[model samples]
Target: MSKRVARIGIFIALAMIFSYIEVLIPFSFGIPGVKLGVANIVVVTGLYMLKPQEVFFISILRILLIGLLFGNVMTLSYSLAGGILSFVVMYIFKKLGSFSIIGVSAAGGVFHNLGQIIVAAFILKNEKILYYFPVLIIAGVVTGILIGFVSDKVIKTLKIQDFSENLK
Candidate 1:
């Protein structure tokens, strides 16, 4: 239990750092609310390195900490929606067995955007936000591919010989 908690803590820390790093970069698509999703690397890594439940646990911690540190209550909806949706997609990818991290992360990106859209629609009580879908999907493609590629490189360099190898 302590080991799992420690892993979750590590993920939260990395996610916070990446989230803050993104804030400093100030890069955005013209679409109002889009980001590079740099912190997703940690989520993707958790999905690949541990069980689905463990990955979910790490994700909840990361999202909570990241949101608390960088955002207020309103922004929490976006992160919560996006984080949960991406985690689900990553779990599906984990089940599929043959896809690359890039593919899986791309899926995560799409789901993340979709989740935010869902939340925006619910919170704002408007369906027009759905129009932002295309731009969000494109942005996801760009960011997700990059994050996944970087994650793959990092995982390779870490030399994790098997899925459970890093569990210890």
Candidate 2:
């Protein structure tokens, strides 16, 4: 139990570090809300390597920590929505076990954007926000694919399944 708790702590820290690194890099593609979502690499890694409950816990904890450390209320709202929705979609896909990691991650990226946009629309009370949906979707796919490939390599190279057994 302590090992699992320690692992979750480590994952949350890594996710937060990645979030900080993302903030350091000025990766603007002329889009307002687009991000490389480098932090999601840790989330995806958790999905592949940990149980669903653990992944959910880590995702939310990372978001909360990032919010408290680096963001404001609006950031928390948007990120909480996106993170929870993305986690749900990814969990479903993981359960289906039909899609490749890339597919699942891509779906998660798209859904995350959608979730945040939805929150933005609600907060701003402007349906025009939907106009950005298509572009965000494209960005999501690109970032998601990139994160997915990196995660796949990490999972394979590290032999996450074998490592999971040791954790057990």
Candidate 3:
């Protein structure tokens, strides 16, 4: 296999590991569907380091693999909804080229939660689930910022841009 393919495989593995780690951690904040978004560190890194399409590929692959490994049909559905929406939002922000990584990631995080909430509302058939929006927004911002900072550090320390060039 080519080095590029190998690198992508490595990234996917890292994302899956992160997802498993997040599951292992009991980080309930008294609100359902709130998470620290640890796997997003890989997603954000890919957004900056890989092609847009490649990033989407990695994100979707990770979500599906995680769902199969650790979740059921409902988990897969919710994850798919949140992951797709988050990826779109982040891609748009990245294309705009105005927002810093933190800003883009923050928006992505917020929208990710929003997407999941929307799915939950539809699944439950209750508008009351929307009440979680405000709290989720705050959680998203916090987790997004955290993920962004970590991604930034990883990008800089690893020289991801330079490495990406080598991969190509």
Candidate 4:
């Protein structure tokens, strides 16, 4: 149990590190609210390496930590929505067991954007934001594929499955 808790701590730290890196790099799509979501690589990896609930805990905790450190209340709202929605979609796809990690990541990315869009629409009280949905979807799929590929490699290279089995 201590080992698992320690590992979860590590995962949260890694996720925060990735988020910090994203802030430093600021790889934008030349559009507002479009980000590479590099932190999600850790989330994606956790989905495969840890239990769904553990992964969920890590993702949410990371978002809260990062938001508190670097973002405002609005950013937190958007992130919470995106993180929750993306986690749900990723979890469903992972449970389906037919989708590749890439596919699951892609779904997660797209849904993450969708969640943010929903929040934006609600907060802005304007439906015009929906017009940006298509672009976000594209960006999401592209980033998701890249993040997924990286996650897949990380999992295999680290033999995370083998390591996590011991946690069980």
The lDDT leader among the candidates is 4
lDDT, candidate 4, 66-162, per-residue tens:
9999999999999999999999999999989999999999999999999999998999999999999999999999889999999999989778457
**What clash count goes with each model?**
0, 0, 0, 0
Note the residue pairs that clash in candidate 4: none
Residues 1-168, candidate 2, lDDT per residue (tens digit)?
A: 899999999899899999999888856777888988888999998898888899899999999999999899999999999999999998898789999999989999999999999999999999999999999989988888998999998788668457766755
- Report lDDT per candidate: 0.83, 0.90, 0.89, 0.93
Report the C-alpha lDDT of model 3 over 9-81, residue by residue, as the tens digit.
9889999999999889945667777888889999999998888888899999999999999999988888999
- Candidate 1 local lDDT, 104-168, one digit each (tens): 99989988998989899989999998998898988888888988999988777666565446556
| Residue 71 lDDT in candidate 1 | 87
Candidate 1 lDDT score at position 87 = 86
- Give candidate 4's error at residue 49 in angstroms: 0.6
- Model 1 segments more than 4 A misplaced: 160-166
* Candidate 3 backbone clash number: 0
TM-scores for every candidate against the unseen true structure: 0.90, 0.95, 0.94, 0.95
Give model 3 RMSD, 1 decimal.
1.7
Badly placed stretches (over 4 Å) of model 2 are 160-162
Q: What lDDT is obtained when candidate 1 is compared to the true structure?
A: 0.83
